[model samples]
Each structure stands twice: as C-alpha cells, then as structure tokens.
Target chain A: MTTKAKRSRLDLRNGRIDLSHGAGGCATDQLVKGIFHRAFDNDWLRAGNDQSAFAVPAGCMVMTTDSYVVSPLFFPGGNIGSLAVHGTINDIAMAGACPLYLSAGFIIEEGFPLADLNRIADAMGAASRAAGVPIITGDTKVVERGKADGVFISTSGIGMIRAGLDLRSDAARPGDAVIISGSIGDHGVAVMSKRENLDFDTDIISDCAALHGLVAAMVEVAGSSIRLMRDPTRGGLAATLNEIANASNVGLRIDEETIPIKPEVAAACELLGLDPLNVANEGKLVVLVAPEFANALLAVMRAHPLGAQAALIGHAEDDDHCFVQMATSFGGSRIVDWLWGEQLPRIC
Target chain B: MTTKAKRSRLDLRNGRIDLSHGAGGCATDQLVKGIFHRAFDNDWLRAGNDQSAFAVPAGCMVMTTDSYVVSPLFFPGGNIGSLAVHGTINDIAMAGACPLYLSAGFIIEEGFPLADLNRIADAMGAASRAAGVPIITGDTKVVERGKADGVFISTSGIGMIRAGLDLRSDAARPGDAVIISGSIGDHGVAVMSKRENLDFDTDIISDCAALHGLVAAMVEVAGSSIRLMRDPTRGGLAATLNEIANASNVGLRIDEETIPIKPEVAAACELLGLDPLNVANEGKLVVLVAPEFANALLAVMRAHPLGAQAALIGHAEDDDHCFVQMATSFGGSRIVDWLWGEQLPRIC
Candidate 1:
C-alpha cells in the first residue's frame, strides 16, 4: 500500500508473488504489461479487445470450450497453457473440423509469479500457433492471493468443418473394431511424475501434442471406417472404452498384449500404486472402426509419427451392458469397468 | 492411509479434507459417489459412462463452451452453475442458433458443501430445461483443498443454428446501428454486491437469464439487419462497442440517455465509485443493425420479457481509431474508452 512496500517488492524476482500482485490497479497492470502481454504479443491479442474479432473461413464452423486447471502449472514436458490449446483443438478436430480461432479467459491467483505467468502465456501462444490456430481474444481476472492457485485457463475455440465428415461418440456400431492411435497413459504419468516429484530416472516426457493434424490424416485415409473417435483424457483408456461400449450398446474384447504402454508409465504406476489404464493421456485417441476396415485403419494410423505406435486392440460384440472386458496380461480375463471415479483431479 | 479412515469417512459430513482426498484411488471414489454423482443425477449422467451419448434436432448445429469461476459462486440471483449454462447458451444463441446438448467439466475444492453443489446443479438443470436444452454430459474433479475455490464450472453447449442466419461478430457493417437487448451491468453488479457485502442493496437479482429464445425472436424478425450481436460479458458495453467499432472500421455515436440502466445499478455504481459502462452484463447484448430496420429489431427484442428494456444505444460513424463517443445525459459528450483497469476480478 505504500512506496516502501512497493520498493521492497523490487527485491522479489519475477519468480515470486505477493498479495499486492493481485491488487486491482497498477500492480495488476504491471503483471499484464511487464510480463503476460509481452510474452503473448500478437496482432489479435495486442489489439486488447474484450473479444477478438476475426474472419472465419467460409464453411460450417466448429466451436469448443475447455477449462485447464492442472496442478503444479509448471509440469515436466507441458503446463496448463499448452494443455488448454491441445484439449480444445482436439475437441474441434474430433468433430471433423478445422480449428481457426481461440478465446482465453484467465483466472489468476493474487500472488502468482509474473515469470510463471509469462511462461504459461507464451506456452499457450506457441501451442496455438503451432497448431495453426491463434489465441484471438482474452479476459483476465485476479482473485485474492489465497483465493486461487497460480492460474486457470478457460478456452473457447471456433473452427470450420469440411463437408461430409460427421464424427460422434454414438457412431460406434455393433461389430465395429477398436484401435488406438498410439501408446496410452504417457501424459498422465508425465504430469504425475512432475506433481509427486517422483524420480523420473527414466525421462518420461508428456505426450501432450495437438491431435487435429492426426485427425485430419485419419479422415483423409478412412473416409468412413472411423465409426467413432475419442481422446481418452482424464479417466484414460478404460473410461473411453467403457463409454463407447455403453453408447453403442456393445461389448468390447480388448487383447491385453496388443495394448501399448510405455515402460516408464508402467513403472511409475507400479510405484504410485496406480493403474496405467486409469492414468490420463493428452495425445492418444481410441478409435472404433467397422470390422472390415480395422486392419487398413491400423495401417493408416501407424504411418504417421504420432500414430507410429498404433494398434488394433479390440472388437465390438452385441451386449446391452456395454462391458469392456480384457484378456489379462497373465492369461486371465477381467471386465474393464468405466473408470469409476476421479483419477488425478485438475491435472489438465 | 488406513482402512479405518476410509470406512469411518462414509458417515462423516463435517470433517475437513486430508491428503488422501487428492490421492487417485478409492478415497476419490467415495467423494464422487457421495457428493458429485448424487447431486447431478439424471439418466445420462447416472449412466456412469465416461462420455454421455445423446441426440439432437434436425438443423445446422451450434456448439459453445464457457467456464465460470466467478468469485463467491453464490451471487445475487444465481451461482456458477446457472451462469455456466446461461453463458454458453448465449454464445450459441448469439450465432442465431437453438441450443441442444450441453457438457460440463468441474474443478471443485475438497471441502465444498455438498448441499451447495446440489443446489447449483439443480439450478443448471432447471436452466437447461427452461432453454429447451439438456446437459447431456458432464465431468467432476476434486482439486486439492487449497488449489481451488469451492467450485468452477466449464460448460460446452451444442445447438441448432437456424437456416439462413449468418451470424458473426465480424458481420457488423458501415452505417449499421447498435442496439442493446436490455439494461447493462446487472449481473456484474449483482455478483459484486454479494462479494463486497454492501448493505446498499435492491432486489437487483442478476439479469442472468438464457437469451436463446430472445435471440431466436430477433433472428426471426430482424433477420438481415441484425449484422452483429455480442453479450457484454467480461468487459461490458464499452469494451464490446469498441470491438464492434474497430471490427466494422466505423466510429460509434451513442446517446447516453438512450442506453438502458436500471435505477439500482445506477445508484450502486455511484456509491461504489464505479462506472457501469465497464461493468459486465450477462443478460444484455450489443446488437448491430442497418439503419432502416433498427426500430423493427427493437420492437422484436422488446416483445420478449428479457429484452423489454431494449433500446437504440448507438450508430456507426466514420473514423479509423474507432472512437466510441457518447452523447451525455446532459446533451454534451465524452469518449467511452476501453476498460483501462480491472473493474472487478472474477466477476464472471
């Protein structure tokens, strides 16, 4: 409140945060001006409008919104900022759409570091640009110092859908085959490693990449074998598989040996007393395909860098209970129930 | 960490959060089963599937996503839950669409009152039903005790865009008039009043209602003249007008007296030393128009209860900097600058 306190704040690095940081005036401006805006400087963001105004390419547009509240905002390979872009872009792409614009609304804790804020914003901007989408407009609000944690990003994305492709979870049909675009649980384990500070003796980078490009590739190849697609996010593969099974009124038979799991993830799960299947994944998709095209789809998926570890793991069968049964690794069988509860809360 | 802690926790209601709450296991399951799943019970939600499968009416569909973390989740007229639905629906409706299915993602603090969450979810469900939309899918995650406030709701909405309405913010044109659907700042003031605990209160409930029906009405009547529409959510009218002005490359001339403001809002602003222009409005919108159809648009908007206070707020003028000059209540003038400082943080 006084010049003395302000001057003392000079001693604190951009890495530190104090009560005054969230004050709704010059202090807050310094945070936005001296850091956030600088790192996120771009034509759309610099315009400083409440909502970004941009041209949507002529066609049917797709819009999606996601809120990112990952704990330990600074994670191993990714943070909440980049996670926001990846999540929203995937939602748009899952609908057979091309992501075009984004709107970011930030809820910041009062005493968050300017440096950390800069890193997050830059990460978001970079991720958006790399995905060929732009962070078009934004809103920022700072709650009391103890009222929030670091920062939370809520993103609303608008995209355009090309003609003809309609993607939905309910599209899965009886007898449809199941395939995974790549290895599962890499992202969940990476974030878990960062949060727990567990020894990452075996470097496990988060598989937190945008999937719109991969979705585009799949659409180009499989015209229609893609009965359904979903990114197994929070509850991971078990949850996604169970969802599709129930939605289509079918049971899935997943071969345990065919499923891909990075050794690091498997090892981490063992240490934490958790299941790799229940862990989160930011860059893997569960694809349901018609039986005839299952192998062809897997081949197409395996061709891409993102899909290099693709696998045909399961098949659909007639069943009202929507069971997700799996052949056990040790040669037994078990029902993979819908991941019944929260795994890691707010881990993006 | 022990079996006693898990079994004993089944009946306790007043206990505080411990570390196991954040651990990914049975503890999290007890919490979701006891609190979240109980509050949000419905056929699709109760199905316990990871993703909800649902249907939609025939037409071009519109989907929107918004996250609400407004401080003091309980406001004058609503909580974060209802606001989440209203905000996302307004976005879809702003596209001249009818909202259909909704999905919600929540980040909740561990000690949040189950009763409060139940009430909020009920409100959201009621709002959805009233808007003729269903919250077909949702998710709940419990953050560590200090990582979040009571709760934050992110809703993704899908709707059917009516035929022939090409609605977009970029659709504003030169010589188009600007109309506000109703009084501004009610929602922002309502939340702020509740937050600050100001005794100076009126029954100034948040004008936080769904605008889809009102939008549908306007779209039916003002079809082509309705060049652009934007709800003044974060930055309020001043910021929204400025955005439209710059987007259309036209300056705006507005009559101060012509803009609608409730008596309570005006009094509250004067007492709090705040400007209503910079306050957010959840229920109000800035509707751009062609000169000739301004009256018809106002008539249509006024026909609805939500738009009863609709008025011609401004008109497009020729200027490059996009100055938003207002004709004062006293017939003099002043520039309505963009909200240069934070009005209220997390005011939603």
Candidate 2:
C-alpha cells in the first residue's frame, strides 16, 4: 500500500489512545503510519529514523524556537496545531531568514479527544505544506488529568539567511521610518472573545498567518533600508515600537492617525477598556525603514496580501534615551507607553 | 557602563513587577536591567536591543528548542532555569553539534516572589556560563495568577556541526552496537522525589549536567563510529531504543545484566513497581556505533567525565519491524515495551 493509504488505515474519527500505542513496538508503528506520518508527510519524516539527516544550505543559518500554550484546544479560525507552525516560522522569518525545518514537542493532557488531536495534527500538516516547511522531528508526552491543560506544543524552526541580508534591531537609526503591516489586536481580541466568561464581542477574527512571504517581499524591496522587524505578538504595537526605539537609541514620533486599527477592534477595545495599541497582534509587525526608502518600502509592503493594510506610521528621531510619543487624535500628544498592568492575561 | 553593569542596575531581589514593567517605558528598562539582562549577562545581551545579531560559523547548524515547567520552582540539583539550558543544549549535542547561542522566553506568574525569581535567574545565568553558551536574547511576560504555573522557561539553542559529521537516526545498521552513558532513571526519580506530597527521601540528586562538552569530546574521538545519538528523556531507555530500531528498520537485542543501574535507582524502581528501563533519564544518551568501533568508542566514552559509567548494552539486528528484546538477568528474553502511561508527568 502507498504511504498515505497506510497512514489512513486507522479510524481517526473515533479513535482512542491505548497504552500500546505509545510503546516502542508495532503499535507505535501503526500510530505513526496511520496518523502522524499521514498528516506530516515528507521525506525527512519518512526516513523512519529516530533522528533526521539532511543537507544544509551553506552560508549563515537562523534558528528559532517557540512554544504554544493556547487553551481550549480548538478555537475560532485556527487550532494549536496551526498556531505552533506559524509561530516558529514567523520567528525565523523575522530574522530575515527562509524557514527550513521544524521540530515539534507535544505535552498531551490525558483524556483529550483523540479526534481533536488528529485534527490538530492534520492542521499542522496543512500549515507545514502551506509554509513549505516540514515537521521533521518531534517528542510526545501524555500528562495525567488535572496536571496539565488540554495540550501544549513547542515548535523549533531552522532557517537560512540569504546572502547580503543584515537585519538586526540595532540597525535602526535616527530618521528611520516606522511601519506596521495591517491592523492590530485581531489575534488577542479573537482569543479573548473565545475565553470563557468574557461576554463581549465585535466581528473580529485572528490575523494569525505565516508571515515569511510578506517578509520575503519586503526583503526583496527594502533590503538594507529595512533596519529591523519584529512581530508585535504578546506586547502589541506600543511595546514593539518602544523596543525598536530603545534598541536604536532613538526617540519615536508616531502619528496616531496613521496607525491602522480596524473599526471593530477599536470599538471592542473601547468597550473592554483596552487600548488597541496595547492589544497583542499575532499577524502584525513593527518595521523600521530608513526615511529615504519609506515611500518605496511602504508601496512594496502594501502590494502583498499580508501587507495590504500596511501603513507608514512614525519616524525615528535623535534621542539619548529612547522615547515613544504619539500625536493624539484630539490634536494632543501622549506617551505611547508599554502595556500597563495585566491588561489581558493569556490573550495570546 | 558596560552591559554587565547596566544589566545589574535593577533591583531583582526586591522588585515587584507592576504594569509599568510590561509597558515599553522606563519601568520596563529597570525590569530588563535588574532581572533578565543580569541573569543572562553577555556582550550580545548588552547590545540592549530587541534582538541579538551575530556571525554564523562555517558549518551546518543543529538547532533545538525546549520549554521548561518544573513545579516548585527550584529543585535539589538544579531548577527549571538550569534544566531549560541543559535540555536544549543536550538535544542539539545529541546530533553532534557545538552549541553557540540561545534564546529564552519566560512567563512569570503574577505575585510570585521576587527573591525566588531572582534565584531562578541566577541559576540560569550560572548554567549558561558553565555551558559556554550565551543567552543572547530573551523575553519576559507576567501572567495573572492561576493563568500559568509560577514560571515556564522556553529555550532555543543554535549549534554548529563539524564538516565531516553526518550523524542521523537512520544511520544505524544491522550488527551495530548500542551504548548508554551512565545509569537510567536518575533525573526522573530525582524530580518525582521532590513532588508535593509523596514525601520521600534518598541521596538521589538530579543528573542535570550539560552534555555538550562530553558530546564534543565523543565526536572528536569517534565521529565516524557513531551512527545515532539520543538522550532517553521522558519515555526512557526502552522507548528510545525502540524508536531507533524502528527508525533504522532494525531490531535490538540488549543484555539486561550489562545495562548499568545505580543500586538506589534499582531499589526505588522495585518498590514503586516501575521499570527502571522505562523510567526517564536526563543526563544520559543511547549511542549507536558500528560493531568494529564499539570497543574503541567505549574506551573514548569512559575517558570522559560524563561517560565513565557508560555501558555497552545492546546491538542492532536486521528486522523490517523494530523490536526491543532484553536478555533478562534471569537468563531469559522478554520484550521491553514503550511506556504507555506517564509514570511521572512533567519530569523534565
């Protein structure tokens, strides 16, 4: 039988995990053949070895790792599986690297639905396919009930940096322009909305996406003009901007009007008393571009699907201590401070 | 001030994190200085940027990521801080790679004791120092109480592989021998013994030393003989060998009496009804070597500090399906199964 056929032999829909499945014998074979190998199909995984061996591209390499612990297992728009894949890929891409391979670690809470896990595995497979990355090696452990949440996945990625690309946060300088791709707060709000007992909502979905493509496009255009790039994930826009400013030893002056925020997100923020600027965005990035190349860079960012809503929001200024200030919508000025308090815990 | 002094400027021991710390402002600066920066002291960290930039070496890179969540914050031999560093470093080393840089992410529970946090940070710093790897970049977040364990450390390591080294799990061939570095069940037993309740006593301390140094030595002496390497962590020796057998499309025949075990570990296993082979190990590895080089490899391993107790326990045999059979101390053969249930959860 073909590999796919063998992988599909198991009754995934109604499957239940038995002790033998985790044992290192025929049962383990059946599990991998019937499930994981099916979803995460590739030459490396099919090597059928405890460790994967493959050729590495020459020159500099970028390696990154991230762990996902979003609760409820299943969520709107995506699951833990896809999130794990995207999170690691984004980390690598943020370094101006082309993601190559991923290693996955699973901490499965006992009694989780086998079907849900299969679904998650399948989702991961789909994400890997889309990202052109593979889940090469993985470790799995099952935790007893009450000891762990449903499931926690940690994914580590390795990517190769293209020659001539020198991206680093310290590269940002005075007069560098600050840019953000798309509206912020979508991911945080979506997860918050799904969280139990938070009974408030607007029409919002997570902007969780694999962003290497967008980054690649930007790299192709901006190249050296792009000083640094960071995904505003847990700490949101304000924190990300502040981070760049501090790294470059420059002050930031952002025009609030130029910052992109979806109307629904703005309203939801108002109701929840959370600033859209401080809300976490899984799919957004804070980019520093030399002022001379801001126009060309903005145009290129706006050209990509992931960057359709990109905007040039701010510029760097000479300052001994990095400071972030914004022109308030009411013709006033305010410090765009980092997230204050536990604004929304576990929002990611 | 140099990066070290700047990092040490904050009050890590007495400081309580507030909203301003998470904010991208002065308070955040203090937090970074007093806590993370000091804990991970290095020139790359002193660059004081959102990311660390460095030159990559001229070889294939092996990268690994791990998240640490050991309850009780601290432990006998090492805390989660050290564990996080050792775990990923050992993982990369298993592939015969030289660890270079690491990225760390911390999720701290709100209201956790500052003193305790500092202790963990110091431990992390010390461990990184001992390993000769730097914590180049890191992130910290304060989650609301009950939203997370007191602390969770996510670490990722990047290492450079030597030019001629081509180690992989699939490289194990029929007639190859398997060897394990030291006794089984030390790490797992140490952790469980520290769990709340089930109060137990023994001189058993965690075998939590970093294995990169030993890996370097082993690879230097017997680079070609080695076919595969794995630190049988969670699922222990039985599961790891089984995985290698399956991955290599071979079967394993291990001499039970030949496997090394501490008398204390054996007694504990007998009393707890646990199979020592199934119990997890942290500071250990199962090495696959060609039969011709097995003795020489053993000599090299024994010459190292971490390998003096290393033992030649098994050999690979041709098999389409992987089977791990043990020659019992009683002069009979029995199947060594993969551990189905987690006898010890979160033992890492």
Candidate 3:
C-alpha cells in the first residue's frame, strides 16, 4: 500500500504552494498526507479525524499560544520553525508545568518554495520530538502570492501542573531575590546582524532552546519559595522587570556589574547604538525567589546546560512608586523604565 | 484605578496600527489592555499571566485548529471574526465533545485601522460568548504594511469528550443512513455576490453559525449508534462525501431532489457556473448513523433552530469502487467525484 501511494507523491524540488492546496479537495488531501503526515508522524495523526481525542490525567492544565513572524525565516542558530516550538514550550515551562501536547497552524504565501516549507516542518518536528512533546493536530492555509511572507506559524501548547504548585506574577514580596539565567541579547543581535547586513568580526548565534528541563530542575529545588518566572523574549529584561515591579507593587534594585552579557553581543549593541537591556533573549529566564532559596535555585539552574551562566543580580525592596533602579559601574543610579516605542520589529 | 488607566487608552477612532504595538513595550501594553481586555473580559485573561491554568476532570480530550484568511473580512451575514469562532466550535462538536476554551493568535498589518480591529475583536467575543466558550489566552503581532492583507487569525480549541462515545471517519457500515442538518451553498454565494458586486434582488445571507446545539441534541438521542459526522466547509458537500466514501470503503447514493438549498443561492450558483454541492457552508453537518436510529435523530434535529431544515438525503451501500452517485431530478444518475482543484479561494 505504501509503495502504491508513493508513485504520485508531491514534487518536492520544483513545486510551490498554490490556492489548490487550501481548497479542501483532493489536492489539499495530497498536501497534508504527503508533507505534514510524513514529517510529524505519530499515532494521533494516523487516526485521521477532524480532531484528535486522547486520554489525559485529572490535574491542573496550562495553555499558551504564540505566533512567529520573524523575518529572514532562517537565522544563525535556528530558523522560525524550531524557534516557534521552543518559544511555546518555554511559555508552558514558566508555569512550573510538565509540557504535554501541541497544535500548529500555518499561513503560507502562494508561490512559496515547497523545499523551504519541508525544511521548516522537519525542523519543527525534530524540536517537538526532542522535547518529548508531539504535534497532535494542525491546520494550513495559503494566501495570495504577495499577501503574506514566506510563512507564519502559530503554535498552542498544553501542560500538566503538579499539585500544590502556585506561581503568579503578583506574588513577589519586598525581600525576594532576582536572578537571571544565562546571557541576554544573543537572539536579538544575531537576527539583527543578518537583517542589517553587518560585517561583524565576532560570531554570535541565537540563544534559542527549550527551557523546560532547566525549569523542572529549579522547581524541584525551590517550588514553594519561588514567587514567579518569566522569559524575556520581546521587550528583554528591562520591560519584564518593570512589569513585575508594577504587578507586585515592589521596587527592584539591581547592580549592573553582576549581569551577564556576551562580549560579542555587547560589542554589536554598542556599534549599533542599541541597549543590551532592551534586546530579546529566547532561552533565558528571570526568576523571583525567596531570599533564603536564592542560592539553592541558582545552584540548580547552573547545573543545567541552558542556564550555565545564571547570575543573581538584584533584590526587591519596599517602595510606593514601584520603580526599578540600576546601580551603574560608574557609581550612578538610573531608572530602567519600560521601553517607550518600537526599537525592533518582528524580532521574535 | 480604571479611570487612571483609561486616560492613556488607544485612539480607536482615527489611529492606525504601528510597529510599536508589537514591540512588547508600553505601547503593546496599552494596545492589549485598551482593546482586547475590554472586548474579551474573563477571569482567566484578567490573571495577566503568560499562560492560563485550570482544573479538568479525567477524561478524553479533543483538540483542533484552523486559520482564517477570508478576503473582504466582512460579508452579508458574518465576518471573519464570527466565522472563526463558529468554525472552531463546530470542529469540537463533531467529536461529541463539550468545548471548554479557545486561544487566538492574530497577525495584523501595519497601518490597518484600529477601529476595524476593535470591531473584529468585539464580533469574535460576542460569538464566543454566545457559544458558551471563552477566549482565554491570546497573542497579537503586527507586520509591515503590504506584507499581509488586513489581518489573519488562527484559533485552536480544546474540549472534553465523554467516555462512552467513540466517533470516527472509518466506522461507517454498508447500510448506514446519511443526513444533512440544513441547506448548503448560502455562505459561498453570499460572499461571492459581495466580492463580484452583483445586485441580486433577493437577499442571500450567509448561513454562518455555531452548530453545537444541534449536534448536542443529536448525540443525546443517538450517541452510541452514530458512526461519524463532518462539516462541509471549504470544498462543500461533494468533497466531504467523497472523502467519507473513500475512508469507509462504501458507495453513497443520494437523491438530488431531497437536498435543500435556498432559491436565491441556487440562482447565484447557476449564474456563476458553480455547483451548489461544491460551495462552502459554515453552519451545516453530514451525519452517518444506524438505519434504525436515523428517524429518531432526524426528529430531534428538526426540533432545534439551526437544524430546522434537516433531511435524510442519502444512504450507504456495499460497492468495491467506493463511488458517490447522485440520482438527479432528470431521472439520471451521475458520479460526484472529489473537487479536482481550487473553486473559491479564502472562503473560510
């Protein structure tokens, strides 16, 4: 049966997406069975129903969604496909949950190369399998030739949160400690370097990876003492800290000398007049924990590969204004307010 | 507190979407709070977290996703917003599941009108509320002008399936009965008339609605005796019936005089050289059930508002070729093959 079906397979080398693929006909069936079914092979997909039905344990479940429209589709360390999977997984991990299943939706432009689409789907499948999660169900649509870019992917994920776990953005206290996992601005700088056509001597790659393992380790060590966790993806650390300060109604004081930043990323930021604080990082996390468990959490984070360069750079304090201030290496203090306007667009 | 926040609200009257709205900064916060929060108000969204977590009973769960790229955004009866909500809810309902929540991802073009965005969100919220399903978590991104049409929305839904029901596409026997909930082709003809600027004397509104209520009634009457259910959306009834015949390895025989269609819709399809069976529908279903229970299910369906025009249009038979033949009003029989290629683009 498999050999018989393979005789009329899609033309992967020279084929391009067209309106017929989205028409819900024989052509649509061929596109789905030929490309998506082969790439994301699993039991649920083989069922071939309008929706996937499966058993789940009775517990608290977490759901998160994100859309990846990152330009240049391909980047230094990862493309949009792998980045989409990693981003959604990290969102689930921020809630101290065990990631379970995912659903994907793709909007492709007509005339887009089938080879590129195949590459993206294969990369996405690899990332999902590596994280122990499966893409159970998905959807695909084709727009006109110029109405969309190459492709835009939207992924939604669900996870299971164990008993007696409570994480909230407004749970931070005045005496909590602030820690960051690994360096900042690596993802933003790598994509920018390619988009701007800059000839930089030093090599920089995106810090795009799934952080569930690191998060699980941290939760194992300090589940009760942890206040909250957030991945600074879009507005970087500065915007995230500001949001936490306002949500928790506490002041944050940081020492700039202790923060971790890659030398190459810092150099690129300096040359482009971009601040490292407002740049994005896909694989890093900002943690707020009780002062007593700060060291234990940092030790556990450092033991993981994704958080090898974890650092404790700040602490919470009581203040009515809920301001976030940084003590510079030059013995001066300044407020790190939320970013005013667009510094980078489509930097996901 | 509400008044203070409203002072810095977005200008929805004459303002246009900009890159800053997707920058994950103060502007992004304003856009989210001012528009989305006001439209889709719920406790889960008010949590202000990256993900939504809640408890569920131990059971089988169903998941489905679809992306809407319908052109003209608005049509006679419904727009893309309402259609998106109805489409996803119906997908879950086909599995005899009760939909719990939905997550949305929107990619808007820069320079699009903010008023239009607000209208779409409000329509989507109303449709969701009407269906008893809430939009819990959502993400928004803005692309450069001309990179996309006005906006594209992707929605994913999760539902809980009852333990005793097992519906599938390949479960149909040789002598099952086929039923359609209501008339077809109204949706496609309505959208086509608007796009082509044809001034039809009679009104032809799209039959765009949520069919969960009708499905629930049918399941209550005949849960275990049902074989499968499908919604004829993109390629309409012909394509969907062809798929079922191929999956179940049976032949289908239908009477053309029994299938209901609005007169204006039939006239429009005839003028446009389109087959009514090939036109899309948003609020209809095709059901295959045990022959003994078909009359009971039809009686229950006719009691509901959405299925007032219900009819038993056809039956399944044993055939090696798995062909779908329709007995025409002219005393002739013809094969209804799968649609060969694109009929109407972006009709979803």
Q: Which ten residues in a row have the lowest lDDT in candidate 1 chain B?
A: B1-10
Tens digit per residue, CA lDDT, model 3, A38-154:
888887876777689889999999999898999889888888899999999999999988999998888999999888988888989899999998998888899999999989999
Model 2 chain B worst lDDT window (10 residues): B1-10
Scored against the native two-chain complex, candidate 1 gets a DockQ of 0.17
Q: Write the per-residue lDDT of candidate 1 for residues A1-348, one digit (tens) a residue.
A: 222234323322545554334433345445555555665566755644333333333355545556677887877788999998888788677766777666666777766776677778889878987888876555555666666788887776666665676666667777888898888888888887888888868988888888888888888888676787888887778877866776678889999999999887888888888777777888888888778888887787788888999998988887777788899889999887654346666667
Judged by DockQ cut-offs, the docking class of candidate 1 is incorrect
- Which stretches of candidate 3 lie above 4 Å from their native place? A1-8, B1-8
Candidate 2 docking class:
acceptable
What share of the reference contacts is kept in model 1? 0.15
List, in the given order, the native-contact fraction of each candidate.
Answer: 0.15, 0.15, 0.79
State which candidate, 1 or 2, has the greater lDDT.
Answer: 2
**DockQ of candidate 2?**
0.23
- For model 2, residues A267-339, the per-residue Cα lDDT tens digits are 8777778888878777777888888888898898899999999998989999876778999999999877654
Clashing pairs in 1: A62-A159, B62-B159
lDDT by residue for model 1 (B234-271), tens: 76788778667766778899999988999989999888
- Residue B312 in model 2: lDDT: 96
